[model samples]
Every structure is written in C-alpha cells, then in structure tokens.
Target chain A: MELDGNSSRGKTIASGVIPFVFVIILMLYIFGPGSDLLDLGIPLPEITIEKIDFVDSEIQATVRNTGPISVEVVMADVNDRIQPAAVEPDKSLERFETALVRIPFEWNAGEPYTIGITIDDGTRFEKEIDAAAPALDFSLDLVVFFAIIGTYVGVIPIMIGLLWLPFIKKISRKKYHFFLALTAGLLLFLAIDSIEEAIDVSDENLAGSFNGTLLVVTIVILSFLVLYYAGEKLVKQANSSKITKHVAIALMISIGIGLHNFGEGLAIGASVGLGSIAFSTFLIVGFALHNTTEGIAIAAPMSRGKLMIGKLVAMGLIAGTPAIFGAWLGGFSYSPFSTVIFLSIGAGAIFQVILVLVKWIKEQDTVLSSGAVVSGFATGISIMYLTSILV
Target chain B: MMILVLSVIVGLSVIAILPVMSEAQLKQKTFVTHSGSVIQTTGEIIDPLYTVSSVEFDPEEFLRNFEYGRISVSESGQTIRDYTIIAEDDKIQEISPGVFFNIWSFNGTVPGPTIRATEGDLVRINFINNGSKEHTMHFHGIHPAEMDGVFESVGSGGGQFVYEFEAGPVGVHPYHCHVMPLEEHIVHGLYGVFIVDPKEERPPADEMVMVLNGFDTDFDTENNFYAANTIPFYYQHHPIQINTDELIRIYVVNMVEFDPINNFHLHGNLYKYYPTGTDLIPSFYTDMITLSQTERGIMEFEYKFPGKYLFHAHKVEFSEKGWVGMFLVNDNHEKNNQEIENGT
Candidate 1:
C-alpha cells in the first residue's frame, strides 16, 4: 500500500507525543513536581532486622515481602557508623518476603549502639547490635548505582534530542554533517566521562582486585561489539518481512534498548548491593529518563508502519522488559564481572543499531538533508550537557 | 500397550527389591571408633569431629576421653545400640555433631536413622530432644513448605516436634535445626547429614562418612557446650591418615554462627563438590569451595599419594586456632608407619 501523507503525519505526531507524555509522567514521579499526589501513600515495603554487628555497624536481616505485590527498594537510610553508607537497595522481595538480608551501617569509630534500617518502604527495622562481626570497609554496590544514574540522567536526553532534529526536520546536507561531527564529539566526551566515573568506583573497592580504569574501558568495548552485531543481525532479519516488517524492526530496536537499560539496572543493583544507594538513586533517575527516550526511539519505526495499538504496546514491552530484568538482576546479584559482560554486550548492540540507522538514512536519498542530521546530532549532545549540568 | 505393561512391571519390581538390598548392606557393617567422640549427652552426638589426631587419648592427662561411636534409634527405645565409627581420610568419615536429642539416629548420626522409605511409604521419625538445648528436625530440599522445618515452627533447647512428610525425591537429604537463625545453631553442632537411598541397587565400594563441621569456639573458656566449645585442646594440630586410591564420600556439614567459607583441598586428588549434596555437576568443580552456614556439601575424591596430606581451612588464621588437620594416605595394605612416629 502506498503511504498516505495524513496517516504519516498522524503517526509521527503520535510517536513523539506518546513518549513525550510518558517522559513528563516519569519526571513528575522522579522530581515530584506540581503535585503531592505523586507521593500518595503506596504501602512501602518493610524490612525486619535479624542481627546487628556493633563493631562494624552492620545489620543483617531479612527484608520481608509484606506487600500484595513485590516492590523494589528505591532508597534506604542507614546509620552514620557505616563506613561507606551508600547502598543500592533494588530487589523484589518475593511475595511473603522472607529473604536473608545484610546491610552495613556506618558508626562513629568507637561508638556502641543499635542499628536501624529506614528502608525505602518508609518502615524502620532495627536490632540490638552485636559487638562482634567485622566492620564494613566500603560498599561497592552504591558506586555502580551512582555511575549508572549519572549516565542515564546526564547522558541520554541529549542523545534523544540529537536523533529527533535531523530525522524530523528538513535540513541541508552540509549542516547535517556538522551535526554528526558534533554528536561524535559529544559521544567521545560521554565515553570518557563514563570511564572516569568507572575509575572512581574502582577506587572504592575494598574487596577483590577490581581496577575501575581497566574495567570501564573493557565494558565499553565489549558493550559496543555485542550491541553492534546483535542489532545488525536483528535489523537484517526484520528487513525481509513485508507484512511484519515494521513490528519486527521495532521489536529489534526495543530489544537492543532493553538490553542497554538492563545493564543500567545492573549498575544500580550492584551499587545498592554494595551499599551505594545515593549514587544508585541518581542512576535510577538518569536511567528512567534515558529509557523514556529509548521507548520513543523503538516506537518511531513502528509508528511509520501505521501498526495497531496492540503491536505498539508489545514492541514497547519488548524494549522495556530488559530494563525490568536488568534492574532486578543488578539488585539481586552484584557481581562486577557479570555486570561487565552484560554491559559490553549491550553497548555492542547499540553501536550496531546506530550504524544500521546511519546506513539506511544514506540509502534513502530523500529530501531529508545532511544539515538536519547534523543539527539533530548537535541537539542530542547539547541536551545531554544541559541535563548533566541541571542534575 | 505391551511396552507400557513392561515398564510398569519393571518399576514396581525395582521398588520392591530396592529396600531389601539396602537392608542387606546395612547388616555387613561393623563397630569402630572415629577420631572424635560419640557421647550420650541428650540423644544427639556431641562434638562428632570425623577426623582427629588420635583415637587413643591419655585418660590421665586429658580430663575427658571418649571413643567415636554411633547411635541408632527406631520407633522403640530398645533398638538403641552403640556402633563404632572408623576414621579414614581415604574412605568417607562419618561424624554427626548436629543431631540434637530424641531422634533415632544411625550409629549416633545427627540426621536421625537413615530410614529407607519407598515412594508410597511414610518415614516416621518419633524423635526426642533429650539434650540440654531445645532442638527440632527440619528436612532440607523437601517441598510442601509446612514440612520444611523452617520459620518459627522448629524449636530449640529441649523443644521437640514431629516432622512427617512424604518421601518425594530419593537422594541424600539433610535435617537440622530449622528454628532460630540456623547459622548459629548449626555452627554450634546442631545438624545431621542424611541420605535417601534410591530404588536402584548400586555397587558397594568401601564406604566411609566424613562430616565437615565448622566450629566457632572460645579456647580460653572451659565450657561443656560443645557447639561453641573449644576444639579438642590437645595440641597444635591433629593428623587424619588415609589410604591411597580409596573411593571416599565426604558429607560436609557447616554448623557455625557464621558461614564458614571453607576450601577443602586435597594434596593431589581432584574432587567433585556437590552443591545440593546430590545430582553432581562436574563443572561446579573447585579446590576451594565456600560452604555457607547450615549448608551441606558432599564431595568424592580418590587420594593418590601415600604421605601426610594437609587439609585445613583456606582461611589461614583458622589453623593457629586449631582449625588445621592432616590426612595420612598410605599405600594399599601398608599400615600407616607414621602412626607410631607420634606417640599416642
């Protein structure tokens, strides 16, 4: 069927509108702007303290799943005695919540007192602290969470804005090239920034031989390759189907985005698991914003196809599931090696998708000029910078 | 139709004959003394360390001396008997320090009497907690959350409860203190290594039981609470001797207040550490395996050398506090000459 101007216009507007609205809602949820309704008392999850180590200012307990459905621990307040008090508390305490939980509390060097857990759920769990167990040297979990939050909140919006301008607006070829150059510069900056954050995280490692500088570079390269190949294969396969083509492409893009999101979640989980919640919170907000853009990107291709609402939702989920899984996995298992492997694969897939998109734009030879592309790329970079500053 | 009938017949026949074969093998066992003690305090075995430096203790110098033995309990109290346990580093060493009172145990094994029950049969254990502490038995890896003696149902310090659950899977299962934060109770010697024999009869190699018990003690104190009591305050270290090429099954139980991450390294033998104590996964291989508190790991290895092999806690500090022990593997038919090198 030939493409109709009205339908195409409607699809484009809808694709952009849906994600924009979602982003607004997400922002409200994150920033609690414009209303107290956002903080409506949703019965927060409860944590029960089992034991406390007075020497280390650490509390060992089970976070009971007393809620109807499993909830994620977005934040927690620990005592000052904890050496590195930051912790990423993100995990779904399965229904009827009875899981072994251990958290370190920071205490004054020679102080003796009970430790309590002011969980994200708003309930406090405490125990009479024991004078035994060793003190927690540092929590690596929080470091990862903060790094992820930084990248998501600080790096992703600009990327979305960059993609938007060139593709949506009609611009000159030369200007688009300039925009692309700008984007390349911005990406280099982001990559370097991420590496620096990674190095900072590594410095906090009290256990194991993990060098952040080495790890960040390794993750970036690995992520680049995994995303690149996987995206290429997916796009190639989806391109062949005329009937399911649009949906398939959308799904492919979503999957890649989802994987990336999951990696971000892992970073959050690892940080929280290691007791880095403040940093992880930043990561969550950043990721939540970046993910909204990712949602839009996945929907854009399908919107052009004039697909049904069901298909769009399905595609959205295909992209979203990875984030959910990643968030849970990151919170559950805080293993750096595993996180690195996952992040590498995700980065690789994203790299591949971008390449395919660039190639497709070139082949179309449409009225969309190079200048618009350049402008779009620059916008993406500028937005990221602005968000980073604001954050 | 014929194939279905044949399969059914085979299954039924196998079920009928499996328990008979297991009973026959149980009769072939003899009495022996392991390196550790087998006391009658409460109904459970106290301080049942499988491998010790010496079985012969100087009664004069040592305030207390006891031989390694086993206690078997049936529904009736009259069936109780003292079974001698042999200490062999090559063969599996059997030590039950976690089984608390009133539960009928096999030769004083913690996991009450290894009762061979068929799929349709009910394994009834009328156990009593005669020990100074309250204790309860909870089956591990069993479904039906109620029967899984977790939560607050399992009591401690002379507390008694009956656990009746269907025999689902046939494999080696464990039963221990399901009450309290098990890390501390199990570490204080309140667990037992259990086995649910399969319906199929397998070849019998020289069988030995070795229970790996993690202890947290205060050596400076004089107390009879074997759970937190000091390790045998005899000397610096104790050597456990074994023979070469022996097929050994080590039933490792970690009963410590804290999870004792142990790495059981054999000098020259590669061992298979079973995560769930059954369905051995070869790839989950490691010289140093970390056993969580209240968890059990059963490993099988063949010793190749005929010399003094050191098997101690990977946490090097444990040795200075008496966490180090030795294994002497001698050639076949060669009596351990080093046995006399250190006077008993």
Candidate 2:
C-alpha cells in the first residue's frame, strides 16, 4: 500500500522535531547549572569512592553502585575537567555493589587533587575525593571531544543531504551524474586522509620489530576489499527474492552502512576514551548529519515506490543501526588501526552503494535526463570536499 | 503405518536419552598425576603436595604426599586451624618436565596445591616465610576485605598469621601471595587454585587440572633475573586430551602482578562463560574470555566432535612463545584407528 501524502508529511516533520528536541535535552543535561540538593538532607542514592590508586599514571578506583537501578558515572579531575572513562551501566544496585573502573591519567607528586564521580541516575550522586600523586603519566586532549561531536552533528547531515538530492529532487540526469562524480571525489579524499592518519599513528610507535607504516596500509587495503565484496553480496542477495525483496534490500544496504558507521563511532570513542574529547565531539556531530542523509538516500527509492509509513520507518531504523553501533563501539575500544580500517571499509562500501544507485537510475527510462544525474553527482562530491576543508 | 510409528518412537527415545548420558559423561572427575603415572583415584588423598605462587598453583605434588601433611580444622569444623605454607629458595627441583623452580614452595611448588573446602567452611592459613622477603596469602574470587589478603598483614623471617574467612559459593577459587615486592615474591613461586565443590551435589568426571599463569621476563638475558611467577608472561602452555563430547569446565583466575586483560581462545570450541564466581547463567558465548586481575571465570564447552584442538591465550605473543596447550579428543573411532595402527 502507498503512503498517504498527509501521513508521510507528518512523519517528516516528526522525524525532524524529535531529533532536534533530543539534542537540546542532551545539551541541557550535560551543561545545565544546578544547585546542591544534598544540603537539604533529602536522602538520595549514595556513591562512594572506596579507594583510588594512581598506579603508573592510571587512576584505578572501585565505585560502589548503591542505587536501585544501574547508573552512568561521570568523572572529572581536580581541575573540574571531565575524564573520559567507559563505565557500563550497572543493572543491579544492591548495597555495596562494586565495579572496578580505571582511567588512564597522570598526576604531579605531592599534589593533592579532587575527583568527582557523578552518577547520572534520576537521583544523581556526586562524590569528591582526594587523589594521590600518580605513578604514571597520561593526558587527555580536548580536540578529540569536539571531533566526535562535530562528526555526528555536522558532517553526517550534510553528507546525508548530498546522498539524497539525486533521487529526491526533480533534477536533470546530468545533475545526478555530477552529484555522483562529486561524491566519488569526496570519498576518494576521505580514503586518502584515513590512510595518512593510519601512517601517522604507526610512525609514532618506536618499539615494534615490523615496519608499522607498511603494516597499516596493508591492513587498510585488505579491510576495504573485504567490506566491498561483502556489501556487493548483500545487495545481490537482497534483490534475489520477490516476496522479501524490498525489505531484504533495505537490510543489506543498512548492514553495509552500519559497518561503516560503526568504524566512525570507534574513531570517535577511541579519541574520547583517550582524553581527546573535543575531537570526539566533532566526530559525533559530523557522523550524525552524515547518517541522517544516509537515511534519506535509502528512503527515497522506497518513497518512490510509495511504501507504507511503518515500513519506511522500519527501513530508516535498520539503516540507522550501524551508526548507533558505531558510536558505542568507537567509545569502547581505543585502537587507531581499528578505527582507520573501519572508516576505510565504510568509505568503500558507500562508494559501491552509490555506484549501484547510479546504475539503477540509468536503467530507468524517465523524463529526467542523464545530464541532471551527472550534475547531482558532482554537487555531492564538491559539497563533501568543501566540508572536509572546513572540518 | 505401524512400522513408521515404531521408528518414530525409537528416534524420539534415542534423542531423549543421549543428553542424559552425555551429562553423566561430562560430570567433573578428579585425575591425579604423580612420579610418571596418571591414576584415577576415588576417595584417597590423590597427589597431596602442591605449589602456590602469585601467578599459578599446582596441586599434583600435594596430592601425592597427602598422608604426611596435616590438615588442621577448627572445633566447629568450619575453620582451618593450622594450614601452614612454607616459602623457601632452592635450585631447580623437578616434579615433572618443563616444571622446575629455584623456589621450593609449601604444599610443595608454585601456586601451592588445590585446597578443597565445602561450602560455609572457614579456612585458616598459617604462612611461614623462609624466603628473603615477606609475603601473605590472598584468596581471589572470594568476598571483600574479610578474605582479601592485601595490605601489610604478613611478612618475612618465619612470621605466622591466621586468615579466617567463611567460604561461600562452590567452584574453583584461587589464592596467592599478596605482599610487598609482589612481583618478585610471586614470580619466584606462590599461587594455586582452591576448589569449593557444590554443597548439594555434583556429577563425577575424569578431572584434569590446568592453570594459566602470566609471567614477565627478559627472554634475551641468561642471568636468573627471571621473576618466574611475577609479571605477566607472553605465553605458557598446558595440554590435555579428552573423549569426544566430554563436558569441560575450565576455572580461570587472573593473578598477574600487573593487571593484564587476556583473551583465552580455544581452537575448536566456543566457550560459554559464566561471569560470576559460580552460579551458572546464560553464557556470553565467545572463544576468548577477557579476564581482569583477580577476576575468576568458569567456561564450559563440549568437544562434541573428536579432533586435536589448541587452546591458549589469543595474545599472539603468548601462544607463539610458551603460554599454549592442546586438547586431544579421542572418540571411539579414533581409539579404534589407534588400536589398529598399534596392532594391539
């Protein structure tokens, strides 16, 4: 059944509104001003830093999860600077329930410092403790945080828009081809940038016997090949079935994109985990925008087919899963090689998908001419290039 | 129609009975290794003399000399009265090949042997330090402060201390030397696994003991600067062979002087991991068990089909060097093949 125009229009508005609201709420929760409610003696869940040891520059502590349900912990150093530590939500909070957490840090000897643990449950628990001089040395940079946020919020949306324009707008075929060419250029640039970064990381290592630079390139190329074939097989299989054809196609495309997005998230997560919060933040924002545009790209064909609203929503979610998974994985595992490999794979798969989309457009005999397609492809590439420069 | 019904009934019966037999076959069994022979013992003190270090524990030596050793218990039968462990420095002593130590440990070697205690039993340990430095026993996989042997509780020059803690949960728990010079003391020799069998009941098995220990050393150096039981090593191997489809539960404890997360990989089996000390929950299925320092994990897997498989730490360096072992599965077919080949 075809989607009614009114319902589709309503959904588009809802989608835009929901994300905007969610982002605002997230910001307020993170940076909002608040007063100390504990002074009033209104008993809330208590979190105590039972022990803190600065062993070899890494801050290790045992946090007692004393609340009813699991809570997210936010830790900051003596300077009130937030420390990036991945503390998984505790599912149970029986009294004195403990979780051992470690954060890579460095401290000056004989300097007394304070650490704050903010439990982000409905009832927040804040504990400040004195930290001893560290036995090791490590530092978290702010650039990573910004990078993560920018990737999710900024770059992602623009990329998504570029992905959709060819199919969504009533443009000339030449414009579409231009958009395709533009996308190709942008992707090629990204791939090169990732390889360079991979080399830089390998170069920083001094203790290994193998040539770090060559190994990084080899792995990146291998990852790209593996992801490319995997994506192609997925698309082919999706198209094989008549009964489950559209759904299958949607899923396959989503998986490829998801894998790619996960790599981006890993990059963001790794940066933040290592105390590069600013960089991580920028990455998150860019990836978010890119993913939204990706959703549009996937939805445009389904929209043309005039599928039901529920099916469309389901397809959107499926496509979005990879980005979400990517965000989480990026935050957890901190490995430069892993991040580079995943990003390259994502770039490759997206390149293949765009190719398939162009082919599909060519086979269709519509009033929209080939010139519009070319122009559209070029536009996609140019926009990405302009944005990459800004980033 | 009658023939079809009979065949269906028979098929269903076979399917139903197979798992029960398999479960019976997989029950935990005890195997004792001594001198140069492997014996299946029922109820006697099977290889009593053992070695406990900071990183690993061997119960085979203790099992062999069980009759001579004294297992003192409290009057209530809940606590150990005089559980003595002597730590001393010695030359290369042999209990088995590739297992030699410059350190002669109480219960006899590194990771003093397995101490079997029932549920709710109180274990009192008396540790004698004959080594150059001080040391204390820390029981891992148990509850907080009460049994956690950290801080300056025991030390050198034949000092005696009593550790009283009620044991809860049933599974293989590990105890090690927790004292200053932690790395040197442990590497020299100190650690072993303690098994707390289920209070209710458990199945029987042809049990074999395997412990994975982490040690760090400058392999290039020839001087005995080797802190054997101390730092996390790149590799150490322990091999075992079992019948096809045998149920195996490996109790793994991390006692590295430095906290090193290891990925335990089994070559041909996917292990179902139980996160907590013992009560089995739906496993987080994976080949590698990521173990943190002082953490204990119990992993179970059935070698359903027969084949020789390798299981070891997936940290490539560990497997290539020495932290490696093999699992040989001998099913009916393989046994038959071997017998034919041997002309026996």
Candidate 3:
C-alpha cells in the first residue's frame, strides 16, 4: 500500500517503522555506550584505550578517562618494556575526556601488544589488543548484556499506550484540551533541548565554526519544511481527514521526540563512558520518566478517532525508542558535532509538529483555559527538572 | 588580508627553497653579506692552504673498548683515557613512542655517549669493524694525518685500528663514522659527542649531553623525526626537570643529516651561548641559537620561574616534525606536580 491516497498506507508504514526505531533506540541506550556506577564526588582511577592505530611506526591510542575526577598519567608500557610514549596537553586527563598518546617503534606485525598505563593515583590499567582493532570494543558482559537487552521493557508501555486509545477516545472534549496542551508542553521542552545538544559536540570542522552552526540551523529549517509539506499532502488525500490528520501529526510528534531522545541517549552514554555509575543510573531514571510522558503525547494526538493497538504501538515505538540508540552511541562513540546534526533535524521536525497542533487547536475552537496550558507547561517542566536532581 | 596572504605565500616559498641551500650549492653561489652591503668581487682569487705537524708519523694499536661479553667504561681520575668503539647495526627499540628506526650506533645508543676529557689528556680510541660495512671514527678535533679516521678504512671483516691524539683546544665536538658517502654514514646513526674541558676548568653546573639528530622514516631524503637525544617529541612529552635558579649546562651537537641546519630555542629563558665552546666568555645571551651539521657548543642558562618551558628548533618545520621538547623547573613540588597532572 503505497502512500498514494490509500487509507491503510500511513498505518502500515508507521507501525513497522515506529517499532523498529523504538527497539533500536532502547537497545542502544541500555548497552550501546556506557561507564560504571559509583557514588557522588568520589574520584576513581580508570582508563581504557578506546582505540588504537599503528601507522608510520607510531602507535597512537585514544584513551577514555573512565574515572570520576581528573587524573594524571605518569607512565605507559608496552609488553613490559619501558617504552617512551607522550600524551598530548601534558597528560592530565579529566573524567569522560579522551586524549591521544603515541609511541614510536617498528612494531612486530600480527603480534598482540598489551598497552599498560599508570595513573597518578597509583592505579594501573592493562589491556591486550591488536594494533588494528576497530575503535569500539563490542565486548559486553554476559549478565549486563542480557540486562541491556531487557531494555525492551520500554516497548511494553508503548504497547499499553496504544491499547489505551479506546478509553482515551471517550474522554470529554474539555479533557482533550488539557491532553493537547500537555503534549505541547512536553514537545516544547524537547525542541529546545534537542537543538542545544546538537551543537554541543567538539570537532575540528564543527567546533565553534560559523559555517557548521549555520549548517545545523539550515538542516533544522529544511526538516520542518519537508515534514510540513509531506504532512499537508497526507491530510489532503483522505475524505476522513480529521482522524487521519490527527494520526499523521501523532507520528510526526513521535519522530521528533525520537530525535530528542537520541540526544538524551548521548548524555547517558557519555556518562557511562566516564564510569560514573551513579550519574548514569540517575540519567536513565530521568529519561525513563521523560519517556513515559512522551508515550502519552504520541497517543493524545491520535485519541480523536478509533486507534487500533497496532497504530498506538506504532506511535509509541516511534516516539519512545530513539533514546536507546542515543544512549549506546553516546557511550561507545560520541562526537558533539555529530550528535548536534541529529538534534537540529529533530528540533526542526518537532517544531513543525507543534505548529500542526497549534493550528488544529485554533480551528476546533475548543475552550482551552490558559490556566490549563500554564499548569500543563509548569507540570512538564517541573517533572523533567525535578527528575534531573536524582543524578 | 592582503598582507596576511602575501606573508603566507612568502613563507611557503622560503620553506620550499630550504633544501636548495645545501652543501651542493656551496661551489656555485656567491656569498651574501649581512644587510645587503659589502658586495665583494671574485678576482684572481687564490685559496689558502694550511697544515699542522704532529709528534709521530705512525700510530700504535690500543685496547678494545669492551672484553668478550662485558661492557667497558672509561676509567675515572685518569688524564690518559683508553676507549674502544665497534661499528655495528642495532635497532633503537622505540625511537619515538612505538616507532623504531635502525641505527649504526656506538654501544647500541644513538648519538652514542658523551666522551669527556681535559685539554691536555692523551685520548686514544681503538676502533673495531664488526658490521657489514667499512667504518672509521672521525673525531672533530686536532690529530695527526696517520690518526685521522677519515682517510683510513677499517675493514668490516674484523679489522681493527687505533686513533690517538692529544686533546687540544677545549670545546664541544662531534665524532662519527667518517666513511664514504659521509652523509649516509652520519644519517644512518653513526655519531657521538666529544667534549674537552678547558685548562682553567669550567664552572661547576648540572651538565647534560644532547645529540641533535633526525630520522628519515619514509626515506624521502627529508627528516620525518627531528630530535634532541634522538627521540622525537621526547622532550616535549618528557621534559627535563631542573631546579629553579640553577645553572643548566648543555653540550648539544647537531648531527642531523639531510637538513642544512638545526637550531635550539628556549622558551621563557635566555642562555649564554658559547659557539665552538672555545672560550669561557659568551658570544651572545639569547634564547635561541642555530647550528650547521656537526656544529656543537656549550650553552648555560637558569630559569627564574617555576614553569614548564618549551625548548625547540627555531626552524618551524623541524619543530613541527617533532624536534621540540619542554623543560620543567620545579620550585615547589605540590604546585608543579598539579600543573603536570592537569596537562597545562
């Protein structure tokens, strides 16, 4: 069923794409990139050679500071030899930051070299790795691996939200106004947040570059225009455009939230890479609460008509699952510039979703008390702001 | 913007022409004096020739530096020093970090070791040919014709010879295997420091030896790794520690081949540079000094502040290619250690 004025076309595409996107994001957030859990203000000495490269007789290793506080690397060894290696910026590395340390030598190809590092705190880390391993270490702990796969728990609530569509449809018109206002509140927060995160990554080409910032802004504006046009086309094709428009706007909201969740995933992943277990735990809880509200936002937009479990599930997955993927990438591989790209596009699309809701709210002439909107917005901000304190 | 563009272009052209001013151009180019003044014409010029006579017409055999399976070190408190060196190929385990370069060194060390002496000392170096090529120890000091290692070839098939000379004028000098294709022999890592103290005795200071050499990693005839003490980024990463307000004496020799010149520039401090190490008096008090190939001298400096300072080649290309290092002067352990830990 192509989207050529077909009734079931949008349903088919939304259901399949939303679930896949949702599951992928959840899985990524849980296991993609992460550090350890620990207490507040406690510094620990830990390091990992996140990547290794041997070229031109120099062995360059990218090391992640998997610790709570700043630590100085006093010495490095290869195969028990007191090899001469130098760390850039004078070797004092902070938590979560990475640095390049290189050693020059004619290496014995095809041989495993164990790179050992000694930090000022007297803690030592040694890992045996080949010279040409890919940047990410995909090795996962058996127990933690199954636990991360369990992030599929996120999909259950999405399924439940889809099933809640029938009862949602029976709500009085005045109650629907509050739900719409609440969804808007949630999305407004996300649009701003997503935009900021997209620009936070450091890179040679993107860091503080006027052109790079312009590129992000351009992508955001273009994303909004593209989604608005496609959404407009979909609404015009159906005889029963009211319900279809609601469903279409709901999917748009989900997609936008998906992008926002990806930014959150990066934050969680970066915290995990830093080996701050307490921070990661707090972040996961905060995001999980945020994700719960997102599911309602996805469903509230579509409660105007009879929404099947399949459609609600599709909407739920579309909106809630991107966080997982964001987390994984943030943990294993994160670049502030790259993260910004996703965030900017998401922000623009989500803004378009808000515009659709605003126009719909005005067209229907529903008496939405400004107090409901103000209270709803206050609740949305307060929930997220309060949850942030747990970390 | 126009000035910036012009300066960039000019900089590029100068760097592009750096390889042109080599020994190969010495015979063809006219000498240009400072400030574009004093242009001298080439008339029916006669090149002057000079020679010095020595005590003996022939040389005597000496002891090998090391016995079988035992390392040999110079005897202390002796005016007459007997030394031995074998020309052989060895690998510097990690020349930079994990980068290794093959070297033809004395005692498996690059730039070898600093051989020190008093001016009146009778120095004898018994040279052994144990490698795959003919080699000789050419000292950049006064010696008789028969003792000059440049003209005499010690065979690789276990050939042995002796070089004996009275250590003349007090100065810092370089010694290397002076065989055919001299640039290759020197660049391939056959070099060391030879320092002779003056008769009046130099001031007591914390002395260190540095041999400035570079590696042709890709062998494109351009140095890829330029360094003092033969390790690229060695000094930059692992800075030499010095006490605040203490004199630092460095006998630095530039044995870098393929490059026409190398220099030493100190950040945050000035040094009394003694060119050729001939006199106790200083020629200039500057933060930087340049040296041609095999040119070496003693430099003295003291840092007043406790900070990590950069010591590098003023030649930007050389410094960029890793001929740079840092010096950390420690006045307080807690303060300096924290700075080092923070990577500042």
DockQ of 3: 0.02
- For model 1, the docking class works out as incorrect
Q: Model 1: per-residue lDDT, tens digit, A141-244?
A: 63454445434542343234324532523444454444433433344333443444445444432112344556666776776776566655665776675545
Of 2 and 3, the candidate ranking higher by lDDT:
3
Q: For model 2, how does the per-residue alpha-carbon lDDT over B1-344 read when each residue is reduced to its tens digit?
A: 99999999999999999999887665533332223233222221111111112223333333222211245566776444346677665534432222333553545565466666666766666667776666677876566575577874655667766666666677767677877666665654577767666676544444433455543321221111111122212122222557875667666665544436555788877977776447646368888777665566667777777767876667654443234556777785765677799996
True contacts kept of each: 0.00, 0.00, 0.00
Best by TM-score: 3
Ranking by DockQ: 3, 1, 2
Per-residue lDDT over B1-344 for candidate 3, one digit per residue giving the tens place of the 0 to 100 score: 99999999999999878777664454332322212322222211100000111111000000011112222334764367777787786544445433445678775666665677778777877778887889888888888988878788988857899888888779988889889888788887888878888878887776787778887754668665677776655556556778876778888888888889989999998999999898889999998888998888889998889989988898977775557778888885664577789996
Model 2: DockQ vs. true structure:
0.01
Q: List TM-scores for all candidates, in order.
A: 0.31, 0.34, 0.41
Residue A222 CA displacement from its true place in model 1, Å: 4.3
Which ranges in model 3 have alpha carbons more than 4 Å from their true place?
Answer: A1-136, A139-172, A202-210, A238-243, A266-280, A325-338, A366-369, B1-344
**In model 1, what lDDT does residue A326 have?**
62
Q: Measured by C-alpha RMSD in angstroms, how accurate is candidate 2?
A: 29.1
